[model samples]
Target: MIRIVIVDDEVFVRAGFSALLSLADDIEVVGQAGDGAEALSVVRQTVPDVVLMDVNMAPRNGLEATLQIVKLPEAPRVLIMTSASPDNTAWQAFATGAHGFMHKAATPAQIIGAIRMVAVGGTATTPEVMKRLIDENNLRNPRHVAQARSRIDLLSGRHRDIILLVGRGYPNARIARELSMSENTVKSYVSRALEKLGVDNRTQAALLVRDSGLLDETLANESRVL
Candidate 1:
């Protein structure tokens, strides 16, 4: 079963999500927390596969929690839930290392699918949110962008190709098909690339690729290959 921990300041929201998720045969609600601090404790104890967290919380918010959570050894996937529309806060959360983002108004199906997606090493956010994240971040960091590009340049051509595809938000299966490699090979490449890049997950790698303006070059190369 896919183990999940629910973190929300609201008791009803926590209970409601737990009850809803319990209906899924493949998912188990392993723990719950009212804020980021409590969430950290619960996460360490449960070692869940996924964490559904509210973006806004007292004492310690989800973004702060996520920043710490993703650094945990073998961290669980964090999906940030928000009642607000995608904005600067959402971008901050993503940049801070959240694996996914979902509006509180999401349908049950969307919530379930997002959890599953992030659990399997995939990101989950709406296209609009992603676009905003890229656009806003692009305007903020030229020096860091240069540094990211320099680090990425150290990788082998194949590793760079895989990472660029990852930045484009393609999953391992699609990346495998595009690169003419097996899915397992794609996963291996991704893992090694993350190590070389010194990032914890695909989202951070993707951000680096985007901030460095490599996504455009990567796409052009991919078009020629296709």
Candidate 2:
């Protein structure tokens, strides 16, 4: 089962999500919190696989909470939900190492689907939000790309190879096979690489790798291996 923690400032919202999620046999609601601080405590206590959190809350907001959460050892995947405009918060969510973002107005199916996606190392952003994120913020602009490349440069060659493969959407077992290493070693290498890259998860690392354009260069260099 995919364990999940629900975090929202509103009691009704939390209760509603809990009730809705109870229907999914593959998902279990392990905990709930009414604010960012409480969410952190619940997350640490529950050790859930995924966390569905609202972006707005009193005192400490979701972005602040997410930053702290991802720093925890073996942190849970965070799917940030918002009722406000993505323009106001989506970029910050991505920066905080969120695995997914969904509008609060999304359908029940979309909500459940997003939770499932993030639980398994996938991103769950809608095309619209992503478009805004890129188009509005220039995340792929030359300056940002250069910054991404600079961070990626901090990785050793071996870690760079693994992160490039990770950007290609390879699972850990596949990465191990490609690199001729054991799965445990691949996991270790990936974890270390992500840490060095300052990303909380593989999805964020993948984004960084993509933005850095190293994956394209790696693919182009593959001909030399023949």
Best model per lDDT: 1
Q: TM-score of every model?
A: 0.86, 0.81
Q: In candidate 1, which residue pairs get closer than 3 Å at backbone N, Cα or C atoms, i.e. clash?
A: none
Q: Which ten residues in a row have the lowest lDDT in candidate 2?
A: 131-140
Evaluated at residue 109, the lDDT of candidate 1 is: 89
lDDT of each: 0.88, 0.86
The 10-residue segment with the lowest total lDDT in model 1: 133-142
- lDDT for position 160 in model 1: 93
Misplaced by over 4 Å in model 1 are 134-145, 182-184, 220-226
Residue 15 in model 2: lDDT: 91
Writing each residue's lDDT as its tens digit, candidate 2 over 1-226 gives 9999999999899999999999889999999998899999999999999999998898899999999998799799999999998885876787788888899888889899888878866678777887775475444579887998999999887898898888765768778888899989989999999899887788789778878877767777886785
Model 1 C-alpha lDDT per residue in residues 85-122, reported as the tens digit of each score:
77777767778888789888888988898898888777
